[model samples]
Target: MNRSAAPLVRELQPGEIGPAAAGLVLDALAARRDPVIGVATGSSPSPLYAALSASGADFSRAAWFALDEYVGLPAGHPQSYAEVLRREIIEPLGLDPQAVHLPDPHREDLQKACDEYERSIAAAGGIDLQILGIGRNGHLAFNEPGGALDSRTRVEILTEDTRRANQRFFDSLDSVPTRCLTQGLGTILDAGQLLLIARGQDKAEALRAALRGPVSPECPASVLQLHGRLTVLADPAAASLL
Candidate 1:
């Protein structure tokens, strides 16, 4: 994907991104039965999920996959991606809990678990649409800067920047896990479409780098430039730099 030619950007008002994103997924569902969707955690996509739930969209037939999960956190932890999705997405949207999937950060054989996850995505016919949020450092999922762009689903050490950014979710900075299991860039690129959402001025610089900067590993999200179809929805503050 050419950096200049890929990723169609849309700058919308504060409350517009959520409904816009929901409409895109609903449209996809209309075109295909049981569409597989990739979900993300964080403030950026929270409104999107809420809008989806409020729209009375039928998610009973859809398959859900999370972008990543923190390692070492016990099951049912409030901060765990699985539990977060369950509370914020699945239950609200009335999605079949059985069809929702997330990486097992606690699996003994983590490599095997990652392999199985990749296989499961393939078995589900790949993700029809993927929702994503860019870290302050421009990481996608847990594919931190300086990591291989072609990486697959696997464990990764959280960068200091990432850990600090996520500290708000924990009791303290030290309480934040140093590692996580994330779908790699290669995995994310497999999605039929990528929908990246952002809000607030804090995200402006990162958003600018991700959407207008060079396609280098230092800015992992820049790899989205290689995607066949990409859509970015951002509030005025987040799109300010652009």
Candidate 2:
């Protein structure tokens, strides 16, 4: 990573990260009439969602967009991002389900679906703030290692590490979808601000590599260095190497 352009990193207790992140979102919403936000799923953001939900923040006018979706999961599958966001973020925050959007990985024409997703983001005035979680392998969204840094919304093969990491959500490793539709680095960078959350010692090395190592596709999260407004909030374990 380029140290000069690295994100402003903050080390906070696990319980504090959620309120801090929710504050950012609430502030953004207050500053704009209808701010658009991009959201990510996984363990890292659970606390943040909880805080937002409990804060009584108004999200009625916010437009929500998801980072990615598994390619083959059923529409209402309990593990699908849609279902996950509904339970974790949307319903809790009292967001209008009609205002939330996600990529359609199950569509027959996935490429077109990706294109439409991109267009929808642009039409909504782009994302004001994008919440993210870095994978252990340093992947951003589902743009795995070696993916183009300037890629757009598209289909990608999930890495073995990604599959294994997500296995906790499924009955078996084989149950995880091998492919996904994800917003590319270019799409994520388009946001006015980026907020990334990570916790646990398992993410320590990846967080270090992303913030202090050379910027490279091999560690996709490293691209955040090029983003002008990026904030990384992590607990001690995840911030250890930084």
Candidate 3:
């Protein structure tokens, strides 16, 4: 497969990015009878999710899968990725809650949980499209720097940078979970298409590293360069370096 092409990068006005992303989702939804959509949770994707919900689009036939989950949070914790996506995308869009899947971090056999998540993705016919966000440190999902490029669904130790970035969602930095179950870079690349959203000046350097820097484990998002179909939406601030 030809995976060396650079992603299509569109720098939109801050307010225009969300609606354009929603339009892409609508196109994907119409093309597939039962689309499996992989979604990321973070500030970058919040606007797209909000736009999708507000557009009154029908997501009932779509199966939503979270890219990762915190390892120790309770089932209903407000900060849990499952709950975050539920509140941000599922409930607002009136999706069937049962159709939304999250990696089960509560399982004692965490590896088994990861394996099951992979199997579940396979059974759902793989992800038709994946929505993604890059961390300030260049991590994708929870797959931190130095993870294997061909890694599978598995648990990963959170880097201090990641924890510090996520601290805003928790009561304090100490409350942030230090580990998570995340889909590997390989798993993310398996999706038929990828849509990466980035905003703000804080993401500029990471976005530069991801879209233009070398493809290596040091910048997990750089793996996007190896995917056949990738689209990136960014504000001028985020795409400044590019």
Q: Which ten residues in a row have the lowest lDDT in candidate 3?
A: 1-10
TM-scores for every predicted model: 0.97, 0.97, 0.98
Question: What clash pairs does model 1 have?
Answer: none
Give the alpha carbon lDDT tens digit for every residue of 42-103 in model 2. Answer: 99999989999898877888899999999988889999999999999878888788899999
Deviating ranges (above 4 Å) for candidate 3: 1-3
TM-score ranking, high to low = 3, 2, 1
Candidate 1's C-alpha runs over 4 A off are: 1-4
Per-residue CA lDDT of model 1 for 1-242, tens digit only, reads 44435678999997889999999888777777868999999999998988998998677788889999898999889999888998999889987788999988888998888888999999999999999999989999889998888889999999999999999999999999998889999999989999999889988988899878888899998898888799999999999999
TM-score of 2: 0.97
Clashing pairs in 3: none
**Candidate 1 local distance difference test against the native:** 0.89
Query: Given candidate 2, what's the lDDT at residue 44?
Result: 97
TM-score of 3: 0.98
